[model samples]
Target: MKSNTPRMPGRPKRQDQDMPVQETVLFTASRLFMELGYEAVSLQQIAKACGVTKASIYYYFDGKPQLFTASVSAVLERARTSTSQILVQPLPLRERLIKVSEAKLARSHGDFETILREARSSLSQKQLDEITSKEEMIHDCLAEHLIKAMDAGEIRRTDPLLTAHAFSAVLMLGIREIAKGTPADKLARDIVDLFWDGLSIR
Candidate 1:
């Protein structure tokens, strides 16, 4: 989930000394973690991928668990912030929802979920709780947006909370598969069709 690019406000400023290097390492490590589960990857592998010595990586992170946690947290927090901003934008409900969806999927950045999955066993209870809280907030944010759309009759009158979670689940599933491919435009079109028209033989 660690992103190479910054996209939100009020984030901790990165220093010139070693932060960028750490970020670069973390970003690359996140992609590897996503494609290969945590249990399957080694610290030496990550260090090699970063083109740095294992000792150099140790300068920034204590170990794999800490590095993995920090990397995923950075990515997830950014994604949440970006998604929140898009979902709460002052636009038409349908447009806002679509924008929010696009932003969320884009924020996935092709490897966020994979890193998240691989980092599961490395997190402490506190880290797990923090992650869960952020995820729940994201879901709630989407539900609130959906409620607005429902009130405006911009979409069907489904239960906002349920609909939001359902939409997110479906979207993420598609995203996971599409991430391995290079067909973004088609993925977007199919998502829109599924959301607007559903799979009914009308």
Candidate 2:
């Protein structure tokens, strides 16, 4: 005779005890969600990529909308942390901005804004707010650095927040046009130079 007991959602049946299963699921989902649009990516695909069952994902996330919000938040937080590090390094503003652009260009991802626009109706106000907050933090990080640059006479005085938005928008456009085999640094320099000419004191 076998015992019939319902399993708890908190403790998932571990396939690999050593692995951080929840983080793994989130990372895999983030990659798929960013590469493919919200509507295109299914929870099953994320679970398959993570080597876990579909039910395992549900244990961690309420549903696809919840998962999408969490996945995008994770991606934005990672980018924010990394970009913060790059901006804080003891480098010229030009070099720092170039490095930032290079970092953005290095990754292969779809236009997240386009994906968000398509998925807007599907996401809840709270979920959208959460994603928007993380994104604003990234922009704010860059804006802080730009403010320092403005004070130091590196770039002309302007709205740091607006400039931050402009730089990100330009990079988003660059991502689509960047040819394979084009050196990241070269493209980065071009972008920085284009802005430097416009933003610098003339």
Candidate 3:
């Protein structure tokens, strides 16, 4: 006499139970690509790190090129989302700019750009265009906010696009300082102070 108990479809056996194999592969590949550069990392290494086989990674992404493209795109998408959120806040332009600057400074420590530069030749034209489109979206968001600020008399009147570019350049300087072991909070404050002082209406 055996008791019948419904065993709940014994939790499907995935490569990683906590996350989908495809997402795991993407995240693992992204980290490796950023840390080792595209040329240095192999699919085998990423698969091993993700507790799956090399074939598993290939199943999700066509190859190394696609994997790299997907990885960089993921990072850029996150940046775009973050910037968009900051832009939509009802705060003054200076406050929003500081927030955006702080967010960029924090994220700039990643080696996403290094991976892109190293893998440029391997990436397809379409992949390059996709990356460019995402980047342009971020810049456009910043420029839009700057234009609004100008119209509201919160900042000095200037070419919004040019001003946004200049602001980005200044924020990039903070990234350099961050790489040199400068505290991000301190650097962010200094950057915001310098940028706001220069752009603020007297």
Instruction: Give each model's whole-structure lDDT.
Output: 0.68, 0.87, 0.78
User: For residues 23-137, could you state the per-residue lDDT of candidate 2 as single tens digits?
Assistant: 8888888898888888899988888888888888888888999989998999999999989999999999999999899998888788889889978999999999999999999
Model 1 has an lDDT value of 0.68
lDDT of 1 by residue, 161-192 (tens): 77777877777776776768736555655675
| Alpha-carbon runs more than 4 Å astray in model 1 | 1-19, 103-119, 179-182, 197-202
Query: Candidates 1 and 2: which is better by TM-score?
Result: 2
TM-score top scorer: 2
List all candidate RMSDs to the true structure.
8.6, 2.6, 5.3
**TM-score of decoy 3:** 0.83
Clashes of 2: 0
Q: Per-candidate TM vs. native?
A: 0.68, 0.92, 0.83
Candidate 2 deviant stretches above 4 angstroms: 1-6, 9-11, 179-182
- Compute the lDDT for candidate 2: 0.87
Error of 1 at 176 (Å): 4.1
